[model samples]
Target chain A: MIKDSTIKRSKVTLSNKYKNIYEKRFSSPLKRRLAVLKASSSIVSLGKYVILFGLSFIILYPIIQQLAVALRAPEDINNPLVLWIPEKFSFKNFEISMIILDYWNAFKNTFKMSFIVMFLQLFSTSLAGYMLARLRFKGSGIIFALVMFTIIVPQTTIELPLKLSLTNFLNTGVNLLGKSTTLYLFAGLGMGLKSGIFIYLFRQFFRGVPEELEEAAYVDGASPIQVFYKIMLPNAKGVMITVAILAFVWQWNDSYFTSVFVTDANVTLQTLTTKMMGISGNIQSAISQAGVWQLFDQDVTKNPLFTSMILNTSGVIAMLPLLLMYVLLQKKLFTEGIERSGIVG
Target chain B: MISKLKNNISKNTKIKYANDDELLKIERNIKSKLAKYHEKCEKLSAKYIILAKRKQETNKGNVKRIINVSRQIQRINTKIQRLVANLNIVHEKKFIKRSIVYKIKKKFSEIPYNKQKIVWGIIFITPWALGFLLFFLPPILKSFWWSFNDVVPSGTKILVNFVGLKNYIELFTQYVIDNNNIFNVQILLFVQNLAIDLPIILIFSLFIAVLLNTKFKGHQIVKAIFFIPVIYNISIISSTMSKGFGLYLENNTTANILLTTQLTTFLMEIGIGGSFIDIVIGSVERIFMIVNYSGIQILLFIAALQSIPNQLYEAAKVEGATKYETFWKITIPMVTPILLTAAIYTIIDSFARAPIYRFLEYAVTESRYGLASSIAMSYFGINLIIILVVLGSLKGLVFYYDKR
Candidate 1:
C-alpha cells in the first residue's frame, strides 16, 4: 500500500522523485518478501497435502486389497463387495497365508538379509562420505568423482554381470587362480539394493556440513578417526535413517537380482513372494467363509500342517519391513528430501 | 570386504599411478591437443554465431539447418576457453584458487607435477570403476564370451566351446531381426516397448506432475494415492489384476486396440459382420499394462517436478508474465533436463519391471533357459543401444554437484 501511494505521489512531484523517503521500499528483496509472506501467512496453503493423501490411497490400495483378500476366505477375494469390507470376516486365509508359507523363517531370512545389508551400507557409506568430505588427503577428490559418475549407469545393464558372479563365482569359487571355495561368500551384495548410490548421497550431504565442526574436534586433541565417529557420524543421523529405510524396502520388494543371487542357498527365502502363492496352492478356495469348508474338504497335499504351513506364512512376513519403515519414517518418506537423496541412487 | 576392495582396486595402477616425469608428458600432450581444438573452435564459432544471428533476423528454416553449425562453433569456443586457461595454469606455480575462471592465460607449461596429478585424476577417473569391476565387469565379460560360444547344457554343469561371437551376431541378425531389420518377438518386445512406452509416460507424467506439484484441492491426497502403488510390488498387483480386474477389462475397446489394430478387419477375419469383439480385448490388455507400471512414471515426474524451483515461476510473474507464458518460458526449459532423466529411467524400467520381463522370468524358471537367455540378451542389447544413443556424451543433464 505504501509503495503504491508513493509511486502515484512521485509522478505528481515528477522532477524530484527521490526527495521523499524512497530508499526503504526496494532495497533488500528478501526482507520485503519476508514481510509480505508474514502478512499473508494466514492464507493456509493446501496443494501438497491433497496430492500426498490421494497418492497414498493409490499406493495403499493394492496392499489394502491384498490384506482384505487375506483376511476373508479365499473365494471372497474376487467378490466385488470385498473391495469395501468383507461381508463376513474370517481369519482362515490369514492364518494359512501365515502358517503354510513358513512365514517365520521367511521373516527371519528377510530381516536377516535387510539388517546385514543395512549395517554394511550405513558403515561403508558413512566412512566413505566422511573420508571424502572432511579429510583432504591425496586421491580423495578422485574417489569422490568416481562415486558421482556411477549415478547414471543403468542398473539393469549391471544385472547380468552381478547375476553371473553369484551363480558361478560363489557356487564354484574358482577363477584363473584356481581358488576353489564355498559358503556362498557373496550371499552377494547386490543387483537391486544399491549401497554404492548411498555412499555418493551421504558424501554429498556430509560435504555440505560445516568443516569447522570436524576441525574443532581435531584442535581439541581428537584424532581423525574419532572426529569421524563422534562428530561427523552423529550429525549424519537423518541421511542414515533415510538410506536404511530405502535399502530395506528396495531389497524386500526386489524380484530380479535376489532371484539370481540366492537361488541355490536360500531357495526357501529368496523366492518368498512367489513361494507364498506356491505353498498355498489354489488359493481360490482360501477366499470366502464357505471356501474354508471347501479347503479342508479337498484332498490336497496334506502333510504335517506345521512345517508345510510355514511356507504360506512368508507373505505376511514380507510386509513387515515396509510397515515398519512407514511407521518410523512417515514424515521423511513423502517429502522433498527423498527427491534430493533419491536422485543419488 | 577390505581384502576384496584391495583386490578389486584397479590392477592397472601402472597406467594410473605412473612416474611423475611420464605423467607430466601425458598431461602436456592432452593440453596441447585441447589448445589446438580450442583455437579451431573460436574461429568456427564466431562465423557460425554471425550466421545464426542473420538467420534469426530473417526467420526461416535456415535456423534449424544452422543448429549443427552453430553448435560446432559453441563447442570450439568452449575448447578455446579451456586451452587459454591451461596456459594460465603454468604461470601460477603455487595456486591460491584452482578454478579455471580465476587463472590467467600464460602459465600452462610451468604448473608442477604433483598439482597436475590431482587435476588429471579429477577429470579422468571413473568412480564406478570399483563397482564396474566388482558388479559389472567380470560376469558380463564372461557372459559376452559365454553368450556367443555354445555351452551345451548338461544335467548340472554345461560343456562349453567358443562359437566366435555367434550368440551376439544371432541376437540381431538371425533369430530376432526380420530380413527387413525390424526386430522379431524377443527383440521387438524390447525395442517396441520404449518406442510406445516412453512417449506415453513422458507426456502423461509431465501433465500429472504439473498438477500434483501445484497448489490445488486435495493435492496431498492425490499424491499419496499415486505413490501408494510404488510400495506395493508390481508383480503381485499385476498377478492379482490379471486374475480378476484385468480379466473383466479384457472385453473393452482399449484392450482390443492393443490386440488388433483394426477392429473391422479383425471381425471380418473372424467371420463376424461387425466387431466389438476385438476392440474389447485390446483395450483391456492395455489397461492391465498401465496398472502394473503406472507407479514408475509418476515417481520420475515427481522427482522432476520437485527439482524445479518455485522462484522461477515467481520471477516470471514479477515480470508481468501470464501463467501460460511462465510455463512455456521458465518451466519447459527448467524441466527439459528431466526429460532426458525420464527417458533413461523409462527405458531401464520397461526392461526391468514390465510385463515382458515377467513373461521372460516365467520362461527362465520353467527351464526354457535357452529361450529365456535369448529374450534377456535381446532386451539387454536393445536397452544398451538406447543408452548409448541417448548418452552419446555423458553430459545429458548437468547434475547439481551442489556444494551446499
Candidate 2:
C-alpha cells in the first residue's frame, strides 16, 4: 500500500513538473512569441512537404499512367473492369512498338547522334562561352547581344530558309538535307538544339570562377588555350556535365530539327523521336505495315483505343532510355551539377 | 653601344644612313635574342645536370637523353658564339639593313598586349562566329526577306517572286484556318496567355526552388522528381495521353463530377464575381502545364539560391532579423539577376511552344512559304517586343553582385 501511494505521488510530481515547464514556456511574452514562431515554422515545413508531395504526384502521374497503360494487354484496353492495374500484364505492346519504331536501329542512331552532338556542343559552346566570359574585346558586347538574339528567336522562324540554304549548302551542290552529318555540322558550330542556352550557362559558370585562378596561370606563362585546358576546364566540370546531359537529352527528344534536317520521309535514317512521331501519325497503317495485325484480332486492331495504346507504349519506349539515364545520373546531377552550374549567375 | 658601332660601320662602309636607325634596331633585337638563347641554354644545362645525377643513381636509359640534350646545348652554344662574332664583324665593317619581312614582324610584335588579347578573343570565337554568320544570320535575314516574297522551291533551289505586303496583309486580315481560327486572334490570345502565365510560373518556380533549397526530409527525392519534367517530351506525351486518357475520361462516369464547375457556380450564386472565378479556374486548369514549364526555371532558381553565400544569412541571423525579412532583404535582391534570366527563358520557351506554331504549320503544309515566313516573323517580333519590355522593366531591379 505504501509503495503504491509513493508511485502515485511520484506520477503526480512528474505531471506537475511538466506543467511547470509548459507554463514557463508561455509565462513571458517573448517566450510565448518564440514558442509560437517555432510552431509556425514547423507548420510551414509541414505545408512545404505536403505541397511538394502533391506536386511530385502531379509530375509523376502521367508517366506512371503511361506505364500502366503500356503494360495492360491489348484486349484489356477497353475492358471497363481494368483501371490502374492490368489484369493481364504483357509485353505484346512493347514488341509491337519495337517493330513499328524499328527500335534497335532508331535507338542506335539516336544514341550515336545524341552522343556526338553532346560532345560537339560541349566543345563549341564551351569555347564560345569562355571567349565571351573571359576573353572580352571590342564588339564582344555585340556578339553577346547576338547570342541573346539567337536564344530569343524561335527555331521555327528560321526553319524554312535554313532548310533552303542547307539544301544548297554554300552553293557547293551538296544536299545536306536528309543527312545525319548536317546535325553534326550544326552541333559542331554551336547551332544545335538549345545550344545558345548551353553557351549562356557556360558563360555564367565561367564568370563565377574567380579570375585569380586564370591570372595565376597566365603569370606562369600559360597561354589562354593552356589556361582553358588546364585551369578553366577542370573547374568547369559542373557546368560541362549539366550542359552535356541537357544537350544529349534535348537532342534525344528533338523532333523539330531532326524532322527538318535529318529525317526526310523518304530517308531510312531516323532517330527514335522522329520514328515515334512518324509512326504515331498513322498508327493504324503503320501497324498493318509492321504486320502487327496478324497477332491481334480484327476487333482489337480496329479499336482506336488500341492504336492509342500502341502509341503510348511507343512513347514510353522512346523515353525509357532517357528515364534510365536520369535515374542513374540524377544523384550527381542534382548534388553536383545544378548546385554548382552557376546557370543563373 | 650597338648604336655607336652601327654609326662607325656606316662611316667605314660609306653607306648613306637613311636606314641607319634600322641597323641600330637590328643590333638591339639581336642582343635581346642572344639573351633569350642564353637563358634557354642555362635551363637546358640545369636539366642536363639533374638528368646526369639521375642517370648515375639509377643507371637507366637517361644516358641517351642526356647525350641528345648535351648535343642540343652545344648547338645552341655554337649558334650564340657565331652570333657574337658576327656582331663584332658588323661593328667593324658592315651595317645590315632590316628586311621588309622583319619590319612587318616587328610591327606586329609592337601591338599592345591587350590588343593581342583581343585578337586571341576573336580567334577563340571564330568557330561560333562563323556558325552564327553561316547558319544563323543568313537564315534569319533570308526568312525575314522571304516574308516579303513568294518563295517557290525548285529543284534544290528557291524561286523567289517579290510579293510586297500581300502576305502580311492576308495574314493580319484574312488568314483563317479551320474556317474560324484567325491568326490575329490566336496570336493575341497567346500573348495574353503569356502575360498571365509568366508571372505565375516565375513565382511558383521561385517558391518551389526556395523550398527545395531548404534541408527537409526526402529533399533529394523531391529535387530529383521536380526535374523529371525537363526531360519529358511535353508535346508528344501530352498529345498521346490526351488521345487515350482524354477519351477514356470523357467516357467514364466520373467525368460528370465537375467539381471545379460546381464550385464556380456555387460561388456565382453567392455573388463572389465572375472574373475572379475565371482566374481561379484558369490557373487550376493550367496547373499541370505551369509545373511542367517551370522545371528548368526551378533548376535555375535552385542554383541561384545555392549560390547565395551563407554569410548573408548568418549576418541576418546575428542581427536578429526574421526569416521573412532575411528572405526579402538578402535572398530576393541576390536572386534578382537570375530572376531576370529565368523570366527571359520562360518567355522564349513558351513562345517556342505556342499555339501559333499550328498556324505556321498550316502554312507549311499548304506550301504557302511566304505566309509561313510572315507568321514566323510576326511571332518573333511580338516575342522580341515582350522581351524588351520585360528587360526594360527589370533592368533597374536586377542587382548584379560584383564579386570582384
Candidate 3:
C-alpha cells in the first residue's frame, strides 16, 4: 500500500531557485530604493545561506563523526587532543567489522533480495497502475479505494497476522522466512515496501498521458496489453527509474521489513544490521569467541571506544554502497527522474 | 428573335440602372475639386514642414525640462496611489479536478458492449487484486481477529481462545500484569508526542520549503546538502539516537558528547518543566531527522509552487497586493492541495515509525502476539481516526485551481 504514498513520498527532492514574490517585486522600483532593497536582500540571503550551510553541516555531522571514529585507532580515540580528525588513522576497525558483519555474504544477500523486490515491484505496480488508470469496469473505483486504504493502514497493524499467516503456510515443515520466497511473494503482490506508491505513481503517470495515444492504439487494433507494453511502458521510463531507485534504496536501507520478512542472517544489509544489533547484546561473548579479538594487544573489552569504533565501522560499511550510489546516480535519480515525474499533490 | 431579345434585355438593364443626369454632373464636379484640393494640400504640407522644423529648432532646449517634469509627475502619481491590501481572505468554493481515469471511465461506461474492456481491466488488476485478497486482506482481518483472541503457543499447535475485548479493556481500564501503568503511559506519551511532532514537522517543512525555494547562488548545492539526511535513511537516526556515543551511560552522562548540542543544556539551565524540556530537546536534537523526513514534502511544496502560473502573481501585483497578502491569497491557496498530501504523508510516516511501533516490535520479540496485535490495532484505529479528521477538515480548505 506504499504505492500512492510512495509517489507522494517519491516526490521529496526539494527544488531550488524559485522566483519568490519579494525578489521579483523588488527588482523594479526607484533607482535608490531598488539598490537599497538589492543590497539588503543580498545580505539577508547571505544569512539564509549561512543558516542553510549550518543546517547541512548538522545533517552531515553524524556521518562525518562516524567516519572520524571509524578511522581512529584505540589510542588516538583515547587522546584528549584528538577530536574530528584522527591522529593515527587505522583500517583495523573496518577489517574487524567486515569479518564480524560477514560483509561479502551480507552484500550478496542484500543485493539479491533488493534486485528481486525491485524488479517484482517494478512490473506489478506499473501493471496495476495502468489497469486502474486506463481500464474501466464495475468495482474499479472500490478497488482503487481499497488500494488507498491499504496505503493508509500501516503494515505494523497487520504485521502479526502477516507473520502468523506465513508461519501457517510454512507449518508443513518448512521455514519460509529464511528463504527469498517470502520477499518475492510480498513484493510481487504490490504489498512490498512502498510498492503501493509505485503502483500509484504509474497510475498517476499513465493518467497524465493523453487518452488519444491509447485510443489511437486501440483504433489500430492493438489489444489493451499490447497498448500498455508497446506504448505506455516506453513513455513511463521516468517513473520506472524513479520507482526502481526508490524501491532499491528503501529495500536496501529497510531494517524493519527485512527484519520481519527475512529472519535469516546475512539475507540483506538490513537483516545484517538487525543481526548486528543482536550481536551487540552479547558482543563480548561473540568477540571473545573470535580469534581476531585475541590479536589486539590491549584488552579491547575494557574500552568503550573500541565498542563504538566497531559499531561505527559497521554503520559506515552498511551506508557506503548507498552513498556511492547516490554520488554516482544522484543527477539521474534526483534531478531528471523528479523533474519528469509530474507527481501532483 | 435574338436581336429582339437582346434589345429587351438592354432596355430592362437601363431601367434597373436608371440614374439622374444631375447625379453624374455632381460626381464629376466632386472629383475635379478633390484634384484641386490635393494640389493645395501639397503646398500647405511644404509650408507646415518648414514651420515645424523651425519650431523644433527653437523648442529643442526646453524639451529635456518638460520630459523631466512629466517623469516627476508620473513618479508622484505612482507614489500617491494606494496599495490595495487583501484584508479579507476569500474562501472560494472549488471543485476537485476530474482525473483522466475518471474521464475515461465515464466515456467507457457510455459506450455499448464494453464487456471486453471490462475484462481487460479485470485481467490487468487480477494479479495485485488476488495478492491483496489472498495475502494482504486476510492478515489485516486476522490481526483484527487476533486482537479479540487470547493466542497461546503450544509445542506443535497453536491454541487461540476467543477473548472478546479483554486485551483492549485490560490494556486501558485496568493494569492486568502487577497493576503496572506502563501500557497506558506508553500509549498516552506516544500519542502526545505525535500530537507535538505533527505540527512541528509540518510547519518546519513548509517554512524550510519557502526558504529553500528562494533564488540564491549555489542553491543546487544547498538542495543536495539538505537532501543528504534523506539518503542516510531512518536506521541511521535510530542507531544514533538509541546506541551511539556514551549510550551505555545514563542519559545525563551522554550530555557531554559532541553529538549532544548545547541547546539541551541551555534549556535545562533555564529550568523548564522536566518532561517538557525533554520533549523540546528531543525535538531539537532530532531537527536534522525532521529535515530528513521533510525532504519529500519540501519537493512537493516546491513542485506545487513551480506549477503556480506567474500570471496570478503579476495580477496580484497589478492590484497592489503586498507579498504577504499575495502569499496568503495566491500561494497558500495554490499549494493547499500539496500541503494536505504532505501532511497525510508525514502523519503516516511518523505513525508508522512511532515509538509505539517500537514497543509493538518489542512485544513481538517477547512472543506476545495477541497483546501486540491489540496495541497495533489500537494505534492504527487512533491514527486512522486522526487522519480522517485531519483530511476531512483540510479538504474544505484545499482550493483546487483547476476547478477555477
Candidate 4:
C-alpha cells in the first residue's frame, strides 16, 4: 500500500512538471520567439514576390521604354517632362523604323533563308539522329562522338576556315561565299544553326522507342530504309514539331552565320539591325549625300540619342515576330517539349 | 527433392512407353521439333505484328505511346501461341547443316558481321560524312594552317604564305602602338566578366527556381516574363542595354535621382559598407544585364529539383532537419550533376554568343582574316582550358546516380 501511494504521488508530480513545461512554452518570452519565426518566414515569402517583380521590371524596362519612345513625337523626345507618357502621340517612329529596316523586303529575304535552312536542318539532323540511334553498325559510336564534338566546339573555331575555303571549294572560278544557296547547302549538311542539339534530341527520343517494332519489320522482309520510313519516322511527331520551331527561331535570330555568308546587298533583317546599330555615325554623311543637309540635326553630339531611338524601334520591330511566335507556341515548347525532349540533361 | 522426384516420374513414364534408346530419340525429336516450330511461329507472329502496327499507324500516328501498347499486346499474343503449341508438339524434320549458303558464310567469316555492319553504318551516315568532308574539314584545316601562315587576298585568288607561326609570334610579342596591354587586358576582362557573371547567374537562378518550384500562384506568368528575354535576340538585348544605359546616364538630373536614392545607397546609410555595397550594386547591375540569361538554368534546376524524390524531404523533416540543412544536404547533392550540365552549357553559350565576337568577325570582313584567326585561336584555346578546369573541379563533386 505504501509503494502504490508513492507511485501515484510520483505520477502526479510528473504531470505537474509537464504542465509547468507547457505553461513555460506558452509564456511571453517563448511566444515572442515563435511569433518572430512566423513573421520572418512570412516576410521571406513576401520578399520573394518583391524580388521577382523587381527583376521582372528590369527585364521589361527596355521594351517599355521603347514603347514610350516609339509612340512619342520627335519634339516630345527632347522634352524633359516627357518620360513614360508622350506629350503628343505619333506613329512617325514606326514609319521611320519600317523604312530603315526595309521591313517587308528584309522580312522576305530573312523568311526565305530561315525557312529553307529550317527545313534543311530538320531533315538532315533527323537523318543523322536516326542513323546514330537505330542503326547498329561498326564505327557508329565514333560517328556519334564526332557529332557530340560538333555540338561542343564553338562555331568561331571553324567560321574563318569555312569562309576562306568555301570561296574556292567549288574551283569553278566563282566565289561561293556571297551566294544565298550557300546557307541552304551548309544547313543541308547538318552543320547549320544548332542542328547538333536537334540531332541529339532526336537520338534521345529515338532511343526511347522499343526495338520490337523495327525488329518485327525487318523479319517481315522490310529493309532498314523501309523500317525507318514506315515505322520510325511516323512516330516522331513531337520531336519534329519541337525541332522545327527551334530551327526557325534560332535561324531567325542568327546574325553571325548570315553575316559571314551573305554580303551587304543581301541584308536580312538581323543583318539590317546590326547595320543600323552604327548608322548614327554615317547619318551626317548620308544627309549630305542626299543634298538635304539643313533638314536633319547637324549636331553630332545628339546623334547618339537619335541612334538609340532608331535602335529602340528597330529592336521592337525585330523582336515582335519572335514574341508573337513565342506567345503562340510557348505552351508546347516551354512546358511539354522541354520536359519530354530531355533538354535539361 | 520434390522437383527432382517429379522430374524422375515423368522420365519413368516416357521410358515405360518405349525402350530407353527410343525414349531418348523421342525426347530429341520433341526438343528439335519444338525449336523449329517456335521459330516458324515467331516469324509468323512478327509478320502479324508488322501488319497490325502498319494498320494502327494508318489509323493514327500515335508515336511513342502506341508502340508501348502494341508491344504489350504482342507479348500476350506470343504467350498464348506458346501455350497452344505445347499442347500439340510435333516431330522434327531433317535439319540442313551443310547448305551452300552456310559453306559460303563460313568462307566469308573473316569479313563477317563486322564488315557488313560497317558498310551499313557508312551508308546511314553518308550524307553527314560527305558534308563534313566537303564543307567542315577544309575550313578546319585551313583555320589551323591560316593561324601560322599569312593570307593575302588577290583579285580572283588568295595567296597563302607559310610564315611558321609569325602571326602568333606577333600577337604575343609585339606591343600595340598604344601603351595599354590590349590582348591580355581584354582576355582578363572577359575572364573577370565570366567569373563574376557565371556564379551569380547560377546561384540566382537556383534560388528563383526553388521559389518557383514551390506551390505558388502566378508562377507561370512570372516564368514567362523571365524567359521572354531568351526569345529576344542576344545582340538586340546587348545593343538595347548599352545604348539605353548610355541614354539614361546622359540625363544628369535623372541619373542623380536614380543613383542617390537607389537601394544600395539606402543600404549604405543603414551601415552596410565596404565591399558589400559594391557587390550589392554590382549584382543589381549584372542582374539587369543578365536577367534573361538565367532562364535555361532556372528551368534545368527546376527539372532537377522536381526529379528528386519527395520521400527524401519527408525523411529529412522527420529527422528534425532544418530547411537550410535540407537544401544544402539533400537538394544540392541531388542536383549537382544537373549543375554540371548547366555550367557547361553556360560556358559554351557565354563563350560563343558574346557580342564581342561580332568585332572579331568584323576583322575578318575587313581582310584581316589572318590576324582575326590568330585572335580567335588564342581565345578558343583559353575557352578550352577554362572548360577543362571547370569540368575537372566540378566532376569530382557531382553525385552521378548509377541509373542502371
- Please name the candidate that would achieve the greatest TM-score relative to the true structure: 2
Docking class of 4: acceptable
Model 2's alpha-carbon lDDT is: 0.87
iRMSD per prediction, in order: 7.4, 1.7, 3.1, 3.7
Enumerate the candidates' DockQ scores in order: 0.11, 0.60, 0.27, 0.30
Please identify model 4 stretches exceeding 4 Å from their true place: A1-41, A130-138, A170-174, A201-242, A264-307, B1-124, B175-181, B244-280, B303-326, B353-369
- Tens-digit lDDT string for candidate 1 (B53-145): 786787655665578787777777676676556546433332122334334322532454335434433332233233345655565555545
**DockQ, prediction 1:** 0.11
* Ranking of models by lDDT: 2, 3, 4, 1
Off by over 4 Å in 2: A1-18, A264-266, B1-82, B85-116, B153-159, B249-259, B262-271
lDDT of 1 at A59: 52
Cα lDDT of all candidates, in order?
A: 0.53, 0.87, 0.72, 0.70
In candidate 4, position A156 carries an lDDT of 85
Each candidate structure's count of clashing pairs: 73, 0, 6, 0
Cα-based TM-score, every candidate: 0.57, 0.83, 0.73, 0.71
Tens-digit lDDT track of model 3 for A32-150: 47777678878878788777888778777677767877887766655667766788888887888888777777777778878889999897888889888888677788888888888
Runs with alpha carbons beyond 4 Å of true place in candidate 3? A1-29, A170-175, A210-223, A266-271, A299-301, B1-116, B175-181, B241-282, B309-326, B357-368
Models sorted by TM-score, best on top: 2, 3, 4, 1
lDDT of 4: 0.70
Maximum-DockQ candidate: 2
Of the two candidates 1 and 3, the one with more favorable lDDT, higher being better, is: 3
